[model samples]
Target chain A: MSQMRLSFLLPLVAFGILALVGGMALYGTLSGSRDPTQLPSVFVDKPAPQTNLPRLVQTGSTTGNNVSVTMFQGKPVLVNFFASWCAPCRAEAPALEMLSKRVAILGIAYKDRSEDTTAFLQQYGNPFQAIGMDADGRTGIEWGVYGVPETYLLDSNGVVKLRHAGPLTRGVLETTIFPALEALGS
Target chain B: MMIATGLWRTHILIGLVLLNMAIGLVFISATTTPAYAITAEEMLANPVLEERARNLSKQLRCLVCQNQSIDDSDADLARDLRREVRSQIAAGTSDGAIIDQLRAKYGDYVLLNPPLDQATLFLWLSPLGFILLGGLIVMMARRQRGAAIATELDAAERARIEKMLASRDSENRPKT
Candidate 1:
C-alpha cells in the first residue's frame, strides 16, 4: 500500500482499537461485582442487641423502659426498623401489621423523636408488642440498619434467622418470612 | 489561490464534522442507562423483598466505580458484589456489617461518600490547587511580559542605537 493509504488506514485501525478498549473498560468498570461477601451479621445465630427505650404513652418522660434480649425469646419475633419520615416505612406498615397477627412484632423507631413515633404508630395503627425509641440510631447501627423499613426475623431462641433490607410487602411476608417462621415451628 | 482556499475549507469542514460526531457519541453513551443494574433475583428471592434490597443497594456504592452505587453499576465486579450482598442478606447479615466488610476489602474508596481522611484530602483539594497554580503561572507570565516591556536600555546602549539609526538614514538619503 502507498504511504498515504497506510497513514489513513493506521488512524482508522487505531480508532477502532481505542473504541473497543475504551468501551470494554467502561463496561467492566460499570458492571463489576459489588456483592457483600464478607460482612457477617453480628446478630446471626447470636442474641438480639439490648435496648432501653421510653414508652411513648406519656409526654416528657426522659426515663426509658428496659427491654432485654429475652423479649424475643420463645415465640418467633419480627423486629422492624422504621421512622415516620421514611415513605417506604409507610408503604410497608400495612403488610407489617398483617404479619403481626401471625408472629410477634417489635418496632425500633430509628433516630425519631418520641412524639413523632407515637403519632406515627397511632396514625398507622400500632401493631408492635413493645415499641423502642432509638432516638440516636445507635441501636439501628448495631442491627445493621442502612435505612428505614428493614426487618429481621428472629427464631424462638432470639437468634437472627433472616433479614430483609427494604420495605416488607405482602409477597415477602408470605413467601420468605412465613416460610422461615413455619420452619421454626410457629 | 481560490481553488486552494476552497480545498482547504472543505478539509476543515470534514474535520469539524468528524470531531462533532465523536463528541455526540460520547455524550449519548454517558447519559444512557446507569452504570449498574441490580436485578430482582440478585437482590431477593422473594418478590416482596426485592424493592427493599434494591433501595439499600442503591445507597451503597460499588467499590470499583466509586461514584456509582452497586445497584447502578453493570461491571462484572459489580455483579459479583451484588451477588455477595444478596448472599449476606440471605445469610441474615446486618447492614452495618456489610458496609464494614466492604470497607475492609476495598478500603474507604468503596463508599460513594468516602469518610474525611488523609488519603482523600487530595481528591477534595486538587481542583482548587490546580486553579490556584494556573492563576499563579498566568500572573507570573504577565508580570514577566510587563517587566520586559518596561525594561529601559542603559544610557550608552541607547545612544549607540540612535547613532546607528542616524547613520543609516543619512546613507539612505539621496545626495542633493
Candidate 2:
C-alpha cells in the first residue's frame, strides 16, 4: 500500500521539479537577467579575429590609414561593430562615448558607406579611437557579428573576454559592462 | 429522426470543410516557392558552383532573421552570407569545410538542424525517455489490476474458474 502510494506520487514529484525549473527560467527571462535572443558567444576566451580594414577616411584623401588588431595589442580594448543605418548603434553612441573614457574602443562601421559613417560620427559625437570600415561586412563575419551594435571586450593579450549583443544602455553598462570590466581587471 | 439526420449531416459537412482546408494549405505550401534572396551579383558564373552555393545557403540559418534560411531571407547579413558561400565555393572550398567554418564562428545555432551533442543530449533523448516511462507506468498499472482481480477472487471462486477452464480445454481438444 505504501509502495502504491509512493508510485502515485512519483509523477507529482517529477512535475514539481519540472515546474520549478520552468518557473526559474521564466523568472530569469522576465527579470532582464536573461535575454531570449542572446546566443552563447563562441569568441569568448578565444583570440580576437585579426582585421585590416580601411579607416573611415577623409572625403578628399585618396589614401587612408588601415585599422588592425595589432595596433591595439598590449592594452585592453573594446571592439564595437556599428553601422550608420542601425538605430541601436545611434542609441548606444553616448554610452560608447562614456565607455571610451575608461577603455580604448575600436569601432568597425559595418556595411556602411564612408560618407554616411563620417556624417553619423559628426552628428553622434565620435567616441571611437579609430573606426574601421567594414563596407562588405566580411570583417563582421570574421568577428562572428550577427548584427550591428555588438560589443566585445578583449584583454591586453588580444583575447576576447566578453561579448555583449545589442545597445549599451546605461543600465547595461552598470549591470553587464562594469562588472565585466572589473572582472577583466581593466 | 429527420432533425437528428440533419444535425449529423451538418457535423459531416464541417468535418469535410476542415479536411479540405488542411489539404488546401498543404497544396498551397507545396506549390509556392520561397522568394529567393540571392541576387544576380552574388551568383557564381559556374552553374555547378552556384548550385552548391544555393544548397549550402539553404542549410545556413540567417542569424539576423532567426527563422529564415539565408537563401530565403532578404536581410543584408543573409545576402552577405550568400555571397560569401558563393565566393568560397568558386574558390574550391568543399561544402563541409565551409559549414564547419561557419559552425566554428557561430555556434550550432546557425544550423537549422542542430547536431546531436552534449548540449542537445537531453533534447534528443527526452522523447525516448518519456516513452519508456509511459511503458513502465502502463506495465505497473496492468500488474496492479491483475493483482486486484486475483485478490477479489475467493478460494471457492478460484477453484470454480480452474474447473471451468479444465472442462473448456477438454471440450475443445480434438477426438483421438
Candidate 3:
C-alpha cells in the first residue's frame, strides 16, 4: 500500500473502532444490563456522611433533636431522602410505612417545607423515627443524595451497606434492602 | 330507522375525533418539553470567582439529571450544585480541592471528566488501546493486501517463467 493510503486508513480505522465501542457503551447504558439510575457510590462501606439537619417540626422531641451520623452508631438505620413534591415519594410512602414496622427509617425532608412534609406524612403514614429538615438541601448533598426518594441502608458501624436510588418498591425492598438489612443483623 | 342509524354513526365519529385529539394533545404536551438552563443571575459577584465557578460547573455532572453538567441541567439538585460551587469558590477553596471534595461525596461519577484512578484506569485507557489495536489490524490488512496483489509476479517467479518461456521457444523451433 502507498504511504498516503496507510496514513488515511489509520485514523479512519481508529475512528471506526472508537465509534463501535462508544455505541456499545451507549446501548449498554440505555437497554443492557447496566442500571442507569444507580450511580455507584464511594460512600458504600464508608462511614455515613456527617449530617446536622434540624429536627422536623413534627418530631417535637423537645431535646432539639437533629439527624446526625452519630444516630447510626451501634444500629443499622435506613436513611431516606424524600420530598412532598416528589411523585415517587408518594408512591413509596406506604412501602416505607410498611418497612418502618421492621426497622428504623430516618427521613430527611429534602428541600421541602415543614408544613408540606407534615401534611404529606399525615396523609400517608409517618414512617420515620426521626425526621430532619434539610431545608437548603446542603445536608442532602453531604449525604450524596442525587434526588428525592433515594434510600441508604446503613450497617451497625454507621457504614453504608447499600444505597438505592428511586422509590422503595416492594420488590426492591424484598430483594436488596431487606437482604442487606438482614445481613447487618437486628 | 335509517335516520337514527346515521345520527348514531355521526356520534361515534365525533367520539373518535375527540379521542384522537386528546391523544394528540397529550403527545404534544409530553414531547414539546424544553431543556432548562441555569440562569445568569446565579453568577458570583467577583468576575474571577464567577469565571472559576462557571468552569467548575461545566466539569461537574448534575447527579440528578444524570447526563447533563450542572451548568446545563435545570434540576433543583443542579441549581444547588451551582450554588455550592460558587460558595466554595467564594470561600477561597482551590478548584482541585473542591472537585476532590465533590468526588469524595458523589464518587467518580460526579465529575464530567473523571480522573484516571484504579477503578477508572481501563475506562480512561480503552480509547487509546482501541486506536492501537485498530492501527495494528489496518497495518496487517495492508500487508496482506500488498502481498495478495504482488502474488502474480515475484522476482524469482518471473525469472522462472522467463526460463520456461525460453525453453519452450527453443523446443518449438524444430531443433534449428
Candidate 4:
C-alpha cells in the first residue's frame, strides 16, 4: 500500500526537478541576454555626469579653452563618443550632422590622437559645437561609456533622456530619438 | 628480469602522464597573469585599503564581459573601473559610498550581487518557494492517499483481503 502510494510521487518529483532546472535555465538566459532593445543603461532618466575635459583643437578655429559638461545646460544636447578608429563612427557621421542642425550636439573623441581626430573631422564634416578630448577614456568611464559611437541625449534639465549604443541610422533617429526628444521638449 | 622490465614500463607511462600535466599547468599559469590584474605599481599603498579594493572589485561586474567579475576581466573598461576604485580608496572614500556612487552611475546591473528589493524579491526567493510548494503538493497528495486506504475500502474488498490471508494461513498448516 505504501509502495503504491509512493508511486504517485515519482512523476511529481521528476516534474519538480525538471521545472526547477528549466526555470533556472530560463532565468539565466533572460537575465544574461543583452537584447539591444531591452538593454538597461544606468544613465537613462538619470542626471548626466559632469566632467571637465580639454577642448579638441579644431583646425580652423582658435578656441582652446576647456569645456565642461555642466556648462552646457538649459537646452537638450546630444553627447557622442567617437574615435577616428571606429568604423561605425564614420558611418554615423552624416546622421549626427543631420541631427545637429535641429539639436545641439557635443562630441567626446575617445582615445584618439589629436591629428587623427582633426583628420576624421576634416573627412567627415564636423557637427559638434565643442569637442572634448577623452584621450585616456577617463571621462568616458565617468559617463558610463562602454564603446565608441554611443550617443546620449540629455534633456534641458541635464537628465539623460536616451542612450543609443550603436551607430545611428536616420530610421532610428526618426522613430526613437525624435520621439524621446519631442517628449522631453528639446 | 621480466618483473623489472614491467615495473620500468609502468614508471615510463606514469612519467609521461606527469610530464604532460606539468606542461599543461605551466601554460595555464602563463595565461592567467591578466586574471590577477593588480601589479605592484597599481596596488594601494595601504595594505588595509588594498585588501578592501580586491574584495570590492570581486563584487563588481565587468560590463563588457558576460558573467565575469571586474577582478577576473582583462578588458579596458574593467581596468578603468579598477583604477577608479583604487583612486577612490586613495582619496579616502568610504567603501559603501563608492559602491553607491557606482550603482548610481552604472545601475544595479554592475553589481555582481543584485539587490534584494521589492521588485527583485521574487527573483531571489522564487526557486526555493517553488520547490517548497511542490513538496507541499506531494505531501498533501500522499496524506490524502493514505487516508483513502484506511477509510474508503469497500466491504467486498475487505472480505477479499481476509480470504487471501486465510488461504495463506491454511497453506502454512502442517501437512498429513
Candidate 5:
C-alpha cells in the first residue's frame, strides 16, 4: 500500500517542479532583466570591428572628413549607434550627455540623413566629441547592430568591453555601464 | 451485356484519370517554394549565385522579427542581410564562411537552427529524457499494481479466514 501511494504521488511531484520552473521563467521575463531585447553582445572582450565612415557633414564642414575606430585608440571611448528617427535615441540623449563628462563618446548616426542628424543634435544638445554618418547602414551591419540606440563601451586598447542593446537609463548607467567603466579604469 | 461491359470500362478509365490528376496536383504543390520576401531588385542576375543566396538566407534568423527566417521576413534588416549574403556569394565566399562570419557577429542566436553544443545538449535530448521518465513511472506503477493483485495474506490471517469459512459451511449443512 505504501509503495502504491508513492507511485501515485510521483506525477504530482513532477508537476510541482514543472510549475515552479515555469513560474520562475515568467517572473524573470516580467522583471525586465531577461527581456528578449537584451541579447548579450558577441563583441564583448573582442576587438572592435574596423569602422571608417563619412563624418556627419555640418553646414560649414568639408565633405571629405571621415571617422574611424582607430582614431579613438589609447583612451576609453563609448561608441553609440543612434538615429534621428529612433525615439529611444532622443530619450537617451541626457544620459549620454552626463556620461560624456567622464568618458569620450563617438556617435554614429545610423541610416539617417545628415540634415536630420544635425537638426536632432541641435535640438538635443550635442555631447559627442565627433560623429560618423552611416548613410547606407553598411557600417551598422559590420558592427552587428540589430537596432538603433545600441551602445558599446571600448577600452583604451580598442576592445569592446560591454554592449547595451537599448537606450541608456539612470538604472542602466548605475548598474551596468558605470561598473564596466570602473573595471576598465576609464 | 456487351454494351454494359463497355460502359463499365469507361467508368474505370475516368476514375483512373481523376486519381492521376489528384497525384499531379499534390506533386506540384509540394515542389513549389514560397518566395515571400525576395524582391526582384535583390535577385542576382546569375542563377547559380541566386540559388546559393536563397539557400543561405533560409538558414539566417531575422533579428527584428525573432521568429521568421530572413528569407521569410520583410523587415529592412532582413533585406540588407539578403543583399550582403548575395554579395558574399558573388565574391566566391564559401557557404560555411558566410554563415560563420554572421555567427561571429550575431552569436548563435542568429542561426535559425541552433547548433549542437554543450549548452544545447540537454535541449536536444530533452524529449528522450521525458520519454524515459514517463516509462519509468509507468513501469513502477505497473509493478505496484501487480503486487497489489497478488497480495498474499500471512499464515495466521489465512488460517483465521479458512476457519471462519469452515464454520459457516458447517452451520449451513443440513441436520443428519
Candidate 6:
C-alpha cells in the first residue's frame, strides 16, 4: 500500500522540483538585460525636423513672432527638449547655457504649461534664443524624443550632426559637440 | 466519526486552494517588471567607457523591478539609473567601483549574477541540494517498498491460501 502511494507521489514530486528550478531559471532569463542598444538607430546624421514655433516671451513688447527653421540655417543650432518637471534638465541647464555662447540654441518645452515653463526658465536662467512651447508633446514625438533633455546638434544645412539623449554635461559639450561643430565650421 | 471525516476533507481542500493562490501571487510579483534601458547618450559618450558601463549595467538588476537589469527596462527608475551611470562614467569612475557602490546601497539583489558570498550561498546551493535530497528520498522510499513487499503477503497470496482450503474441504467430503 505504501509502495503504491510512493509510486503515485514520485511523479508529482519530480514535477514539483522541475517547476521550482524552471521558475527560477525563467525568472532569471526574463529579468535579464533587454538593453536598447540593439534597436535601430533613430537619429544618426538625419536632417532636423522642420518646425515653426511661436516665441515663449516677446522681448520687444510686441506679439510673439513665429521662429521658423530658416533662422537656424547657416549656423549650428542646438535644439534642446526639456520640461520643468525633469530633474536631469535642471542638472544640465548650466552646462547648456555655457555651450550657448559658442552655438545657437533653441528650447522645446515638452508637455509643460507656459506659466510653469516661464517660471522654470526664470529660476534656471534661460540659455535659449527662442523657446518653443510643445504643450501637448506632439512636436516632441515629431522630433523622436524618447525623454526629456535631449539635445540635437544641427549643421548649417539643417542636418542633425549628433543626438545626445540625456543632459549636456561639460565633458560632452567640450569633447563631442564642440569638435563635431568645429568640423562643420559654424 | 463520519462528520469529523467530512469536515477534515473540507478543511484540507480549502487549505490546498489557498496554498495554490499564494504560490501564483509570488510568481506574478517576482516576474512582471522590465530590467533596464541603455540610452543613446551613454552609447555615444566614449567607446571604451560605454562598453564597461554596458557590461556592468547588464550584470546589475534593478531593485524596484527585481528581475530586470537597468539596461533592458524602459521604466523611469531605470532611465534615472542609466543617467547616473553616464554621469559616473563621464566623471571617470571605474566599473568595479560603481558596482561596489550599487551593491552597498541595494544589497546583493542588484547583482544579476551575485558573487558566491555568505549571503548568497544559499541561493546558488539550494537547487542542487533539493535535487540531491529528492533523489535520496526516492531511493529510501524504493528500499522501504521492496522490504515491505518481501515481508508482507499481498491479496493474491491470501486468495491462493483460500483456494487450497476449499480444495481440501472437497476432498474430505468426498471421502466421507
Most TM-score-accurate candidate: 5
Give DockQ for candidates 1 onward, in order.
0.02, 0.44, 0.32, 0.43, 0.48, 0.07
- Cα lDDT tens digits, model 1, A33-108, are 2224223344666666665665555352435565444776788888888888888998988888888888888888
Would you list the rank order by lDDT, best first? 5, 2, 3, 4, 6, 1
Model 2 interface DockQ: 0.44
Better of 3 and 5 by lDDT: 5
Candidate 2 docking: what grade? acceptable
Candidate 3 lDDT, tens digit per residue, A117-141? 8888888889998888888999888
True contacts kept of 1: 0.00
Give candidate 3 misplaced runs (Cα > 4 Å): A1-33, A59-65, B1-36, B152-176
Clashing pairs in 2: none
TM-score of chain A of each: 0.73, 0.88, 0.80, 0.78, 0.92, 0.73
Give the least accurate 10-residue stretch of model 1 chain A, judged by summed lDDT. Answer: A32-41
Sorted into a CAPRI-style docking class, model 4 comes out as: acceptable
Candidate no. 5 TM-score: 0.84
List the candidates' TM-scores in order. Answer: 0.47, 0.82, 0.74, 0.74, 0.84, 0.44
lDDT of 3 at A113: 86
Kindly list the per-residue Cα lDDT of model 5 for residues B67-128, writing each as its tens digit: 99999999988998999899899899999999999998888988999999998999999999
Candidate number that wins on TM-score, 1 or 2? 2
How do the residues A90-184 of candidate 6 rate in per-residue lDDT, one tens digit apiece?
99989988888888898988878778888888899899998888766656645656578888888888887887767777766776788987887
**Candidate 2 chain B lowest-lDDT run of ten:** B34-43
- Candidate 4 residue runs with Cα over 4 Å from true position: A1-39, A60-64, A184-186, B1-34, B144-153, B158-176
RMSD to the true structure for each prediction, in A, is 20.2, 7.3, 12.4, 6.0, 7.2, 19.6
- Look at candidate 2 and tell me the lDDT of residue A7: 80
The predicted structure with the larger DockQ, 2 or 5, is 5
lDDT of each: 0.72, 0.88, 0.85, 0.85, 0.91, 0.75
B1-176: candidate 4 lDDT, tens digit per residue: 99999999999999999999999999999887553755678788899999999999999988878478888888887888898999999999999988998887777888999999997999999999989978987787778777877887789999999999999999999998
Better of 2 and 4 by DockQ: 2
